[model samples]
Structure formats: C-alpha cells, structure tokens
Target: MTTPAIPSTLDVALWLFDQSRRDDVYLPAQKLQRLLWLQQGGYAAMNHGRMLMPAVFVADETGPIEPTVFHLFEDSRPPIPARPIDQVAENHLVRMWRRYSHHSPDYLTKKITQQRCYRDAWRKGAGTVIPFEAIVRDFTDLPTGDQMVRAGDGRALKKWTPSAKPAMRRIR
Candidate 1:
C-alpha cells in the first residue's frame, strides 16, 4: 500500500486555510471540505494511487465531506495548531488551488456529487464512504491536460495552461 504523502488531513486542511488566507479569500466550511476531496482525488490520479493525506470522504447531502474537518470547523476554525506540510504536499495543494479556488462551494458540490465516486456512495446510503480507490478510478482516466481544469457541471472540461509559452506570438 502506498503511504499517504501528508501525515494528516488536518495538516493539509491547515495548509489550504493558509493558501486561502494568502489569496485574500474566505474559505467556508463546505468549500474547505469539497476542496480537500478534490485535492485528494487529484493527488491520487496524479501520483499513481498514492494518497495525499489520510482523509476519509463521505457523501454528504451537500457534497463530499471529511467528518473530522467538518466537526472541528463547522462553526469556525478551531484552535488546532497548524503543522508544516512537506514541500511535495504543498506543491500539490497549490496546484489544487489553481484548479478549484476560483469556483464557489455550490459549484463544487454540483460537480462533485455528479461524479461516479460520489454517486456510488450516495446511492449506497447517506454518509456512505466514497472509497479512495473509487475516487482514483474516477479521476485516473482524465486526459493529463484536463486534470487540473475544473470539471464544471458534469460537462467536458477544456484544458487551460496558463504557464504555457505564448503561441509563437502569432508569428508577427
């Protein structure tokens, strides 16, 4: 079994909080959960089934949620000390931020719930676990170029590369 890249979900969550704070954005409880879910799945897809953090996601009525994160920060971020995540995990989290941070919590909910991973879990029953394998399966086949693009509203995602060099400057 591949070990998780990050030691704990809380550390990753704290990193995400720091990321949002750096961006001058406010992260809601639900948004934080959905982002965590996306990052975990994205990390698995990118890293050959290795989990980014030891997070267990359940299908909630709204969307995917990590219960530990939800219970602790349901009202406000608790006083838990933030741990320093390794550079690798931080890099992955930054990639995830670029992918989904612009979207709203509602958008994430709508898109994520439609995914097979979440659908299968919800069909099983409320609070059913969305297994990591299932999530990896759902994400693994995405074209590499589109993996970082938000899967908006169950529609096919268009690849966007911000860092790609300008296309020959149109040969002006």
Candidate 2:
C-alpha cells in the first residue's frame, strides 16, 4: 500500500482555525504555534518516530513556531483560508487542541519555553530551528514522557525539576 499524503502547513493551520471558530473562542497565533509544536513532536514521540506533519518549528521568543504557519497570522489576525486535511491528521489535531486548549497562551508559552528542547534550541533574539530530533530527545529523556505520549497527552509529561546546586537563574 502507498503511504498516505501528509497535509501542508496551511491545511493544518486552517483546521486549527476552524476549531477556534467552532468553539467561539479567540486563539492567538502563539497558542496555535504551540499546539502545532505539540502535535508534530508528541505524535512523533508515540508513532514509531513518524511525524503527523512535516513542518519545521523554530524557537521563537514566545515558543516553538512553524514560520510559514506563523506568517498566516503575522499580524495577529488570522485570515487563513480553510482547506481539507487528511482524516488521520484531523484526528491528531483534535486531540492536541483538547489536551491544550484549556491553558492560556502565557501558560503554554511558559511550559514549552522551560522544556529542554526549546531551551537548547533557542538563541536570544534568534529564531533557531527546533529540529524534530531535539524534540524527540527532550520527551524521551523526561520522566514518564514515553508513557505520557502513549496516553496521547504529552503536555502532561513530567517536568524537569532542578537539582539542588548553585542557585542559577531563578525560574518563573
């Protein structure tokens, strides 16, 4: 059997936009970027290293962002044209939204920024590309991360608590 076609970044973004409209809620571009980050990274973590979408995420000041997708809402106004996505991708998107939509944009940004993958990939004032491998490494290295991914809620994966050492920069 042939491999199924993966949806473009635009298609995925539109699907997310549809969800926002349906919920009658406002979803900022930053939150949508984080959701896509989770969708691609978390899905790969659980699916034998397969990506749900072939999008490249960069370490933006706010969090991980797919640049192409971000441009769709560069003005913080979403005018993305809707398009159909594969059923499988649609399902993954739905699950990600449910798992994360409850949190505010700031919360999501803080959560992702604190993670090792985002931390290591980010450079101050530079939007470095967050490689898929880096994301996989972060989750797999976390406590119970694999289990969390299997449960389809990578967001709930255990966080990295700092060890007692020289008090480095304070978090929060």
Per-candidate Cα lDDT values, in order, are 0.82, 0.71
TM-scores for candidates 1 onward, in order: 0.82, 0.76
Off by over 4 Å in 1: 143-172
Q: In model 1, how large is the Cα lDDT of residue 8?
A: 92
For model 2, give the 10-residue run with minimal summed lDDT: 145-154
Q: Estimate, for each residue in 1-172, the C-alpha lDDT of model 1 and write its tens digit.
A: 6889998999888888878888998899999998998899888876878999899999889988999989987887777888878898788788778878999998888878778888889888889998889988878765543343344243555445687665565565
Q: What is the C-alpha local distance difference test score of candidate 2?
A: 0.71
By lDDT, the best candidate is 1
Per-residue CA lDDT of candidate 2, range 94-136, in tens?
8878877777888877777878878887764458888777777
Task: Find the candidate with the highest TM-score and give its number.
Answer: 1
